[model samples]
Target: MSEEKDLFQIKSCGGRKEADEIKKLLEQNDISAEVKEREKDFVVLVPNSEDIVNEALVIITSQEVYDEFYAGE
Candidate 1:
């Protein structure tokens, strides 16, 4: 079988919880993603494809906005 393709970092989150939330959002949108903890930061990773990476970024940005807005309530 062929080797598994590498995942590229698309976003850096503050912590594991935030990274997991973003990863879950990406998966919910049918885009595969994973979270990697790098020292004090969490990095979100997705397949090394341009289209998927762009889509994931859009979704992550939207979710972050929504979260920030609602978090103030």
Candidate 2:
């Protein structure tokens, strides 16, 4: 593992509930993960079409972890 301080974004989850679950899995696999909240925008086209903003969490990890758990996603 290179001494890289650079952290990479691995996955973006819609909510914290899902983010935490993923975090647990990653940690169990020996990959440290962090969850950060970000703005999420979605368009709903039912009844009244409108753009909705929501809070989303993303998974962050080191380069080595990212490479090890890429999953081709």
Q: In model 1, which runs have C-alpha deviations exceeding 4 angstroms?
A: 1-5, 71-73
CA lDDT for candidate 1: 0.85
Predicted candidate 2 versus true structure: per-residue lDDT over 1-73, tens digit per residue = 2222334445667777866666675666545556667777211111111211111121233433676778666
**At residue 4, what lDDT does model 1 achieve?**
30
**lDDT, each prediction:** 0.85, 0.45
Clashing pairs in 1: none
Q: By summed lDDT, which 10 consecutive residues of candidate 2 come out lowest?
A: 46-55
List, in order, the clash count of every candidate structure. 0, 0
lDDT of 1 by residue, 1-73 (tens): 1223667788998989988988888899999887778998999889888999889888988988998999999
Superposing all C-alpha atoms, what RMSD in Å does each candidate have to the true structure? 2.8, 15.8
